[model samples]
Target: MSPLADRYGRRFPYLRLSVIPACNFRCTYCLPQGYHANPNAAQALTLDEIARLLRGFTVMGMHKLRITGGEPSVRHDLTYILRTAAAVPGVTKLAMTTNGSLLTRRLHEWMDAGLNAINVSVDSLDRAKFARITGHDRLDDILHGVDLALDAQMPSVKLNAVLLRDVNDNELPAWLEYLRERRVGVRFIELMQTGDNLPFFRDHHVRATALETQLLEGGWQALARVADAGPAREYRHPDYAGRIGIIAPYSKDFCSGCNRLRVTATGDLRLCLFGDFGIPLRQFLQADDQIEDLVHAIGRQIDRKEQGHFLHEGRTGITPHLASTGG
Candidate 1:
């Protein structure tokens, strides 16, 4: 059967899989300020389950996969999982989203295991501020990992910077300078009020438009038509090797070209980031369902997808954190 297409006619060719709900850092904005670093109430998917689920999705015309998590690098079997996921038929692109601190020793193995690209989360360039924002003093480790990723020849290594007011927002130019020198893609994300940090969100959030203005005034050139290119709107300074992108989930919602769905580490399929409900694939796994059945199950979930999220509607509903909802 052909894979399901939403009412907007976008095909479901992408799946963002969260390998685990656990994370090493307790980024203040990620959860409540001073929130514990424990995993969410959800249980993550096992390796066998993820492989079997991907096999089914592959059969159903899924083409791209992103291995994400609280920090996918924190998962012990990440290299093995990446290898297995890449080996699956029809998976043309295999990628990961990491915090970059743990990429020291395993990066080479991950590249050998066929990770096509990577996106690393880097909030601040200043070591002290980095430690304050991420609740970790591993800035040196993260910087080292970035070099390793470039060395491993990972195609399109993006450095994701989550912009916060009065925090790392002042360091955007410095970030661009550092990353451009290394020829990496630097993406800035607008802080969202969703998830466990709803209260804290009010204090730290900044509009992406404001951020773009800051970057341009600082001599950065805006790349044309990036807002139309899905979620992240990219820009660059002329002659700079690195490009800058902004993910404005709060300020500028990108629901029209959203051809992505999320499969939680635990196997619950989520249609939209703000949509709280998901279909449980674990039942099918336990019942020994056929590959097609699992595929159809995912398709059914997509069919029920809402037009977009209600974030702009005063953030009425509380969405899950970045960890629970894989990027």
Candidate 2:
């Protein structure tokens, strides 16, 4: 494998690719009310073009590729994209992030197509409350889709529940119970700066420390760290085969092992999720730019990644929504 380290000594071997700019649901913490249905209607990359970009990334020593979206499953050709990514020479893992509404029928095919794992966005359990959070009434569909994932024997299926204060914070125990019964991993993601809906911080935020205390009280033991986990501090229950993860990007910082980079659906290279800067890789690809040139440019961009995202401490912020950058 090629040396993956950048000028700042940060290695870059993992890449998150957003195959589609469009999504099916309108989660309040994500997209805005009048957000365009097609953020890239004028410039969505074709599946073949997306494959070419992945090829470039692999040539630069990228080994792990995650497919994210505006909801990745909503894309009709998502399986094709996954297959293409898995088929890349140096790429070893192809995972996806989705809302889990559309996984009922196609999950088996996805597994067969070399999709190694999945991260489903499920915030609330109460049907009406979920609708309030996501502006969609597909909780039942999501539940069914999760079942389908376990049934399909996905290697690393994880449920991603973004905890919100007063809304779902009190329901963490209940959510853990539900997953415990099913024997699936659950990850609680602290909500960060993303869409226009995040207007204030005082009432909406819940720190990960509070959630960890609640989990311990609820009988979930903290299993020691898995080897070299990038940002998440993982724990496992005593008896259950499943585990739980806490991503505390807000209260705690994991900028040191931050080796990830994002490729927007329209093909911009986002260096850091919270930093307001990116170089347009799609523009170069569309201009028939050479692969080696693209790799060198991406290396230059990662060398410029911000030291950290200090939003609460009052710093300049990234302009694009978290969805656009593969949060």
The predictions' CA RMSDs to the true structure, in order, are 2.8, 2.5
- Alpha-carbon local distance difference test for all models: 0.77, 0.75
- TM per candidate comes to 0.90, 0.90
How large an RMSD does model 1 have?
Answer: 2.8
How many angstroms is residue 220 displaced in model 2 relative to the true structure, after the best TM-score fit?
4.2
Q: How big is the positional error of residue 75 in model 1, measured in Å on the Cα after superposition?
A: 2.0
User: What are the per-residue Cα lDDT tens digits for candidate 2 across 1-327?
Assistant: 365565667777788888776677777667746246654354666777787788788877778888998788777888888887788788887888888877887888888889987888888888988898888899999889888888767777888888788787777657766866676777888877653445634557778888787667867776665322346677777756677888888754567667778888888888777777667887556433577777777766666777677767654356456676678
How far residue 124's Cα lies from its native spot in candidate 2, in Å, is 1.6
Per-candidate count of clashing residue pairs (backbone under 3 Å):
1, 0
lDDT of 1: 0.77
Q: Once model 1 is optimally superposed onto the true structure by TM-score, how far is the C-alpha of residue 11 displaced, in angstroms?
A: 2.3
Residue pairs with colliding backbones in model 2 are: none
lDDT for 291 in candidate 2 is: 75
